[model samples]
Target: MQRALAASILIGAVCSVLSCYLVLKGWSLMGDAISHAVLPGIVLAAVLGLPFAVGAFAAGLACALLIGYLKENSRVKEDTVMGIVFSGMFGLGLVLFTKVETDQHLLHVLFGDMLGITPRDLIEVAIIAGGTLLIVLAKRRDLLLYCFDPQHARAIGLPLGVIHYGLLVLLALTIVASLKAVGIILVVAMLVAPGAIAYLLTDRFERMLVIAACVAIGASFFGTLISFHIDGATGPCIVLLQAFVFVLAFLFAPRRGVFALKRSNSHSAG
Candidate 1:
């Protein structure tokens, strides 16, 4: 239980930070693609007697790079390319999964078993989350500029390729780190929901980051608690809480929410 709580906190924090960039950049599908694309890597790693993280990271990075390459080299659109690559890889993973004999449970890989997290798993999450947070915080300005305006970022002397690929690498790493806690299917929610909720609440990037982190951490902690009492899956509980929060922010955010907008309009009419 302690390890589960600890893992949730770390995963929540790291995921929320990247979630801001993902929301700003409109890369929700990209997050989904990478998350799904790691399955084959996980399967192969099991067969090869390698760590799941090593295989998952390699596959995720490959997926990102492949999407980029296909989008640039061919006439196919980015979203289409992402759909193709992820679906294909996911299909391949399912096929391989059936053929391979491994101790890993399919449900756990797909949905995560947060309560089953071991001490080693907790340590891995901490290292990945801590390292990812450091790098992202250090390059927040560059990443922000890139997300807001790639052309402007280039005009201002930023290395567009490095920033672009660096963000992808970070995204991949984040997903890899999150696998044991949230699994592939739900990790996208972790990567998206907190930033989206924060986006609705704030106009500033820094504030967005803070709000996102708070939302994620709070959800993770409370969701884990809820799951324990209710005999629920921790990952889904965390994601469900995030979804609930998103709806709240959507309706009640001071500036951007539906109710807030309606209030402003009424005041304007008066």
Candidate 2:
């Protein structure tokens, strides 16, 4: 249980960091789609008897690149393209699952349990999370610039294509690494909710990242505890805890909270 909780905390912190940028850049649904798209990869890996994460990551990166390519060259809106891609990939996953006749694969991908996590899994998560953090931190300036103004980045000769695709690769790895604890279905909630809540509280990117990581870590720890006590599913419990945090942040956060807005309005009127 201690190991499970520790792993959850680590995963949560990692997801929080990536999610801030994802939410800010309006790529939240992209994360969601990638999460689902990896399902077929996992199934295929199992059939081939290969490492599941590798297969999942490869599939996810493919989907991300496809989406990026389509968005850039086609007149179709990004969301619409993503919707079509998500549905097709997810459908393929379902078909693969039925063909494989592996019940565990489907269950694990959809609703993973804390008890299912192992030391090896935790270590894999750590390595992926650490490497991703280093890359993101090293390229923070470029990423921030690209996120805010891609045209400016292009004008400055920043290789927008490389940076854009790199971010998606990192996102795919993060989702694959997080799958064990939150499962593919609920991982997006973990990725987006904390960041969204933090965004409502701060305009500065650094501060938002800090707050988002804290919220995600806190929710993971508390949710794991609650899941243990109540004998419930850990993934859903964590998601619910995040929702609670978001609610509190939305209602009480200084700059964007309901009370804060009312106070500001009243002071202006006064």
Candidate 3:
């Protein structure tokens, strides 16, 4: 239980930070694509006796780079290319899973085994999550400029390529960091929901980051506690809690919620 809480907090922190950028840049699908695309690497890593994270990072980075390349070179839309690449890689991973006999459980890989986390798993999560947090925070302003106005950023002599690929690399690493605790499938919510909730609640980017982190941490902690008591899946419980928060923010947020908008309309009419 201690280890689960620790892992959840770390996951919550790192994922929430990145989630803000993703929400701002409209890269939600990109997170999903990279998460699913890491499956083949995980399976192959097990077969080859390498750390699953190494293989997962490699595959995820490859997927992100490939998507960028195709988006640049082909006539196909970016979203369409992302859909194709992720689905194809996911399919390949599924095939490899069927062909390779490994000890790792498929359900665990897909949904996560948070309660099953070991001391080593906790350490791994700590290092990756810590490193990712530092890098993202350090580069926050540049990344924000790049996401908000790529053309203006380039005109100001920013290295758009570096910022672009750097963010993708960070995104891939984050998904890799989150692989064990939330697994491939549910990590998408970890990457998206908190920032979305924050977005609805605040207009300032800095405040957005803070609110998102708080939301994620709170949800992760309580979700883990709930799951422990109910004997439920940790990842799903965490995600569901984030969803619930989002729904509340959606209906009650001061400036952005449904009721808030309705009130504004009524006042304008008055």
Tens digits of lDDT, candidate 3, 1-270 = 999999999999999999999999999999999999999999999998899899999999999999999999999999999999999999999999899997866667788988989999899999999999999999999999999999999999999999999999999889988888889999999999999999999999999999999999999999999999999999999999999999999999999999999999999999
TM-score of each: 0.97, 0.95, 0.98
Q: Which 10 successive residues of model 3 have the least lDDT summed?
A: 102-111
lDDT of 2 at 248: 90
Q: After superposition, how far is residue 224 of candidate 2 from its true place, in Å?
A: 1.1
Off by over 4 Å in 3: none
The clash count of every prediction, one per candidate, is 0, 0, 0
Q: Give per-model CA RMSD.
A: 1.0, 1.5, 0.9
Q: Arrange candidates by lDDT, highest first: which order? A: 3, 1, 2
Candidate 1 global lDDT: 0.94
Residue pairs clashing, model 3 = none
Worst 10 residues of 1 by lDDT: 101-110
lDDT over C-alpha atoms for residue 256 of model 1? 95
Better of 2 and 3 by lDDT: 3
- Candidate 2, which segments miss by more than 4 Å at Cα? 103-105
Identify the superior model by TM-score, candidate 1 or candidate 3.
3
